[model samples]
Target chain A: MERTAFQIDARDNVATALTELAPGPVRLAGDGEAEQVEAVEPIPRGHKLAVKFIAEGADVVKYGVPIGVATADIMPGSWVHLHVMRSAYDERSAHLNLRTGAPEDTRYE
Target chain B: MSRKEIPSLEELRALRWRGYAREGGGIGVRNCVLVIYTVKCAEFVARGIVEGCQSPDVQLVGFDGCTDSQCAVNLLAGLIRHPNVGAVLAVGLGCEYVQPERLAEIAARAGKPARWLFIQNEGGTLPAVERGTAWARELLDELRNTPRVPMGLSDLTVGAECGGSDFTSGLAGNVAVGRFFDLLVDSGGTAIFEEIVEAVGLDWLLLSRAANDRARAELRHAYDKMIAYCRSVGQFSVSPGNFAGGLSTIEEKSMGAIAKSGSRPIQGVVKISVPPPEPGLWLLDSTPDPNPVQYGITNPNDSEGLMDLISCGAHVVLLVTGRGSVIGSPVAPCLKITGNAETFRRMSGDLDFDASPSLTGELRQDEVARLLAELIAETAAGKPTKAEALGHREFHIPYKYQEKEARRADCERR
Candidate 1:
């Protein structure tokens, strides 16, 4: 199988896109096993693609660690990014809300 | 990833490089003559003096603040007495809080040639530059004769930092550095990593690598302090560049950033500007102490972070950049590594090591690590890094509000 995305660790549900992937079937490989995942959208290089289905509020695993939680239900091959996920540690999400004039949250404090 | 074959411990101990032996039993890879400005007002005159001398060994460094902060003073003193420096020429405007004479005294106490000139007292810029140039030339001549010693890996204190990172940084560049750090620690050498803000979500991961219960608690405290400091400043470690480079959140960045520590048991955590007590993998808690209000956030720029590492007695800093950054430090040499093959190709002249092979699977992590160790040996033996050859000495000291001053400011505001 031609590798289109890279799963950094065996436990990672999100694999990094190795190249600019158009909407198509992408083969992800790691730890001696290969899996076929479809790209639901155009994914740029260095961006993450969901290799496993993640329910809303579930953790997005990468590097064998939980990076953050999904804000929306993310299906396999969907782009895993700020639009569907947010940082678990930083509650403010100030960067995302800057343009929307969203009220600042004190949850981080 | 599995560990690759490494040199035997006995063979590792045999690795040696010629370095300048400092008076205080320290080995320096580069014998630099530093022209330090006490305040920003004197920076121009200091640069003029260094330019007039026209010596690669003579470099410029300084603090930009006019008011005295003990932190600033301590950091400046450390750089002046750094092993890499053989002599120092301190320049001041005379009215600033930092005294040029005092800085020169630090160098003198270290048995290094030291001189001071106040721009105000020397009849302004031209005269100060003339005197400073002559003094720098003399210092350089004297430094040329500094005794060289054969130093082993155990004698080194290496610092690792990542800037302008992308996803490949963790998978390639930082991981390669982590492997190098593992070898360094295994060889009884000291290794340090900083930027606690980037370790926010990965505190537990770092804690798990602590050498003991005490080290674990210390790591936790550092992480807590970093979180509080960031919250106070209403900022996070993630930048627009970071997001564009494929990092979606601080947690993602933290996971990648912590990879530079490798899998070694962290001996302990030390405060900023304090060297590690023993040889092992250590973390430098660069967060400001006492939790001062109105104090700015940490890491104003990559150079400041590198400077902080240097203040902790790092002989050389391994800077991993996936998005590309061209920077260096005056007190410690910088070896820039890049994981992005395109970035390496575009900025090959500025970067030092290409760890892109790890990304392409052409070389295993440990193989790249071995290559990095060889590069470090070459650098310590006087091979100039790209930054050094190109003369990129970017230094900055961020403003830090003292705890007492912050308290007073709060009272006044109320």
Candidate 2:
């Protein structure tokens, strides 16, 4: 497949999206390139892009350690977010709610 | 890292300071009194005590939980010993998952005199609040009696990070942070950086910097898994802000963002909620999927991520900003350094330190390092950070999900 959007280092698994793309409608270049791979999620701008088919129940690699896992089956060019990649701490985690500067140490003090 | 050949105070004016920026260990800029809670039920009482206290150094921080034994155990164990806390006051409800006395015992073990207050046992909220307030006041007075002992710069650990990032983050703020990291490392002081997501496309560079083949391979495997998992759901990990800021690809962002490490060799990697086991140079495994439940949510912004390091015991934080960040952690001092000269000019009052000199080409690398080292020394002795002075306390407590399947996965990772 011809690399489109984000380019992946030959040594890395993740690709950076060069352009914003809708799920299941974009064409790309490479061995696994698809004209419209079913998008598991809406890929945000400047985030990681999948170069090939990634299985669910697997680790999400960025710098190489697992960031999170795929909650469901995804195709090429889908946007990934809270719905697909679930977090353990959803309610008090600062990542979900942008406001409220409460500290993560939830002990009562 | 060697101690200053000969120490002198006048170096403060010459921008040449003795006992500043030692190599290996990261130095702290502030010594804080951490007021902690042991469980959810005691939160209000703890807050009342903190609010009524007269000491400006005490910071209120805690966790929330009812009876989940495991959760309470983790929160209490982590918060009480977090490095940012110089003195600790652990509050709890008598019947909470974690006992307040147990927390006090733990703190006492660490050689920090811990005061305990139980809301339920102490005659409910009002009585507990009254007693806790009076006790905290006494503790503050006791803490003040301890003289400020001069410590070496190498005795400090300063965490470096950036969030709410823009394109300039890599070019300006992050780079400055890297420079500061390098200077600290050379001096035998420790400077740690995290945010694995920012390393999406820079695996090769990180692998090369890895201390051993195991870490190098681990680095590659970790990034690959993140990408695969993200792609499995058909969603891109990139954000719109990155595109708007003119980043064409994740690789571009990764390369720029990783530069904040300032050419330091990777010592080792640590998991979330884990403090750097040993100082030197450490790469905290900060890669988190966009999921709120699996990965932590408290660290949405870069400063928040830095706060994690602070919890692990960083005495100070070098917060780099390209756009602008006014927030700061309560326990530790945050030295806000801006890469964008325009942003620095506009938010001069909100900023504690400026690295705009690098952008102007007027200051060389060593000169900036010398200036930053001086700032670190002064702040360490006892100076209020920009965030503290402005009362910019931004807190976000992450909520743990109860999905059976997800919980299983989380358990496996742990």
Candidate 3:
């Protein structure tokens, strides 16, 4: 059977979509075991998908390392990206004034 | 996965090629003459001379800065005396800080044929171009009689670099090269991997693989310096293109990049332009030795990285690109590899090896490694890479402030 997504490491909480997948049930497997997760949104190829539920301020694990921390509660099979996650090393906000290079105080923080 | 399939060192050493014998103890895979400009001002005439000579074996390279930089002088001197070069033709604009005469003297001291002509002294552009062309042709003729000796894998030092990366880079391209590094190291050859900025998140993992206690400390210090350097500059090595290709953060990109080193215990770390003390897997710390007061936070472009590898005495560089780049170096031959099957098809003319089979699950990692080893052996035996065939001789030298005090402060902070 052709696998739709791959877990890079056994300890990873996220899996990389092998192909573009529409919102639905998807099976992710690697290093022997298989787990099923419902896709909450469209996941593009090479993009990350939450294989395990992650809470706000929790580390997003991939390749057995913390790629970033979640900004909000992320359910299993939800698309993992900039919208719901942010780089652990990068503290600057997205809403920045290009001219002055300063972060703007905004809503939904 | 098993050592049963690995070839014996004796069998591997049987792979030999005819190479130019250096006066000292080294073998040059290419017998070429270099036409180098002392400053950017003389580049046009230098290019004219190389173009007029019309030979792939005659290459042109130079620094752009006019200021006297010890780094630039050392780099130019290294290139002039590279084992691959049989002779040198130094071009100058007369007023630049790096005099062509000094480069010529270095080449001459190494028993290589060297000549210099100043653009200002030769009555400007046209006459200088004509004279330079004539002299370059003479140097080519002189190098034709250079002796060729039998050389093998032990005499080679190979460098690995990754640029324009995508997801397949880690899973396929870099993984395969890592396998090749293992084979090369086991066979008593030198292999180098650089770009400490890309190594940010892999520090502890890398430190665990250091050969000894001192190496572990050096690895730790180098990684700390890299992180400090990046923080001071308010930037990281991740790029927009990397994100577009699916990498989300510097740590994610680093996880992919570090796979190029394979699984060998890192022998030690050496500063930029310094060759490894012994033949094993060594890390070239591309971070400026003493942190400069002002430095470009981002990794320098591919060419500068390639030159750093060459400065460490690499005879060839394995350049892995998932997004695909076509650049090559002047003295060292670059073998371009890509793990994207689509990219390989699109840029077949520019790429040399395709490790995409590893991505498609058609070939195992060890199989890809074996294939790369065969290709590397062929390249060492004088096969021109795609970049060499397409005539891509790109060179660049970056400028950064050199301050000893800043380096001391950086060390103290660590």
Index of the highest-TM-score prediction: 1
Model 3 CAPRI rating = acceptable
| Model 1 TM-score (B-chain only) | 0.93
The sequence of per-residue lDDT tens digits that candidate 2 reaches over residues B49-85 is 8888755667776666664534334444554565445
What docking class should model 1 receive? acceptable
Give lDDT tens digits, candidate 1, residues B82-194.
78989999999989999999998988898899999899999999999999999999999998899999998888899988998998898889999999999999888999998
Candidate 1 local Cα displacement, residue B200, angstroms: 1.1
Could you tell me which residue pairs clash in candidate 1? none
Per model, kept true contacts as a fraction are 0.48, 0.02, 0.23
DockQ of each candidate relative to the true complex: 0.39, 0.04, 0.27
**Residue by residue across B4-38, what tens digits does model 3's lDDT show?**
35444456667888888877557898888899998
Model 3 stretches with alpha carbons more than 4 Å out: A1-3, A25-32, A35-38, A92-109, B1-13, B289-292, B401-410
Model 1 earns a TM-score of 0.92
Sort all candidates by DockQ, best to worst.
1, 3, 2
Would you list the rank order by lDDT, best first? 1, 3, 2
**What's model 3's overall lDDT?**
0.80
lDDT of 2 at B363: 67
